[model samples]
Target: MKKIILYLMSAMLMVSLAACTPTQPKMETTPPDPQVMASTGGASDKVPDPNAEPMEIISVYSKNDNKTGLNQAMDAVDKLTAEAMVSKLIEYGVLEEGTKVLKYESADGIGTLDLSAVPQSGSGDDKLTIAAIGNTFIENFELDKLKLLVNGKNYSSGSIKQGDNDYLEYVKNYKEIK
Candidate 1:
């Protein structure tokens, strides 16, 4: 009787221990819906749309920095803006005989740019260059507004200092794009 009782208790304990053990999460083996799968095509089907509108790059000008003076910031801005402009021009195939950007007024969180010094290349690279230049201007200037002009004419949208809407849209539509 003692032996039988001991055996029963051991079996009960074993059963309780087995019950307490956690079950593994189930793996998904079945393929997704055929219609959804067809729409996606394959893993490498994602590509950037050329027809999509490019994101706008906002210009950021500096107001005041205690650590770095406005002069230092302005100097940095000059260098960066020049480089960006050059790069954009080159990318847009608009390299001309005498293309230069002169600083008209840059102070108190405002940058007045003069492009009259730049010769007309007519390379159709202006748009590409402007995008690059605008993006660069925004990144380095830290200013509130950057006014762009071509040959002393206000050709572009007045300010490149706003936030990037395209980037935000991209982030939001990532799932759809993917």
Candidate 2:
């Protein structure tokens, strides 16, 4: 009788221990916001102004060329071209409503465009702005190279190193603008 009771008690204890062990919790993942995901519907989001001003390209004939003369000429041309391009884009509704051209200049065969524009209300992406600015200048400029500078320095990669920020640097060849 003692042996049987002991056996029963051991079995009961084992059963209780097994029941007390915790099970893996189910992972709960909520789906992304529907409104955010549904914002971009189709190809219209990627279209830019076809007649926007071309990208400005400065040319340095030689490594020993006069930097001041080259910069002055490039700056004059860049200012005009940038203004025209931004105006055209805005007129065609390709740019956002409040978008505007803040300034532009070229130095030693490098043109930098500064814009005070933001994506449209529903666009939610600045890719179109980037494409438009790069492509338009490349198409309109004589040289095949340029750089984009926001504020007072280069925004991305190119030949010019305006400052010391990694993500802010955007470099591209003129042929690669399209």
Candidate 3:
């Protein structure tokens, strides 16, 4: 009789201990939809719609020291048609204060940007300023690449060309100046 009670008590203890073990919650593995990605400000490679009506939206980035600032969103403008958007970028502090866009036009999906003025001093500032303008045009418009001209001269004398990925690569690789 003692052996039977002992076995029963041992089994009860084992059962209780087994019940006390914790379980891991099941995890979800599905990707979110594109609308969810956009609303959350997640980066997406989806190109802008060319046929949609034009409006203005600010796409901002900081070159160094992650700091957030004020932003107001509206419909994105048609970059090809909106010359004022470049001026507005300077006004809104998206571009540097003195940056100027003399002309912005596209032919056969290749964009040509004429800048009346650009950052002259500080290698970091020059890189970021150029990248900001080029990236803004590339991201906003349906362009294969951009030809940047300053004061009616080719930026870097045929060194910056489309289809070779040099310009895009440079803009992307630009490290921020302190």
User: Which residue runs does candidate 1 get wrong by more than 4 Å?
Assistant: 1-97, 117-127, 156-178
Better of 2 and 3 by TM-score: 3
Candidates, ranked, lDDT: 3, 2, 1
Q: Write the per-residue lDDT of candidate 3 for residues 1-178, one digit (tens) a residue.
A: 9999999999999999999989788786888876656454444555788997866564533344432222333335545343655665565455656667777778887788777765454444455555656666665675677777777666652222323333432244434322
Every model's TM-score: 0.32, 0.36, 0.47
The ten-residue window of minimal lDDT in model 2 covers 62-71
Ranking by TM-score: 3, 2, 1
Q: Model 1, range 43-160, lDDT digits (tens) per residue?
A: 5677877987655343332212231211111221224455455444444433343556755456776655566443332433333334334444544555455566666666443332
Per-model C-alpha lDDT, please?
Answer: 0.45, 0.48, 0.58
Q: Which 10 consecutive residues of model 1 have the lowest summed lDDT?
A: 166-175
Q: Which candidate comes out best when scored by lDDT?
A: 3
Give candidate 1's TM-score.
Answer: 0.32
- Candidate with better TM-score, 1 vs 3: 3
Angstrom error at residue 50, model 3: 23
Residue 12, candidate 1: C-alpha displacement in angstroms: 61
Top model by TM-score, which number? 3
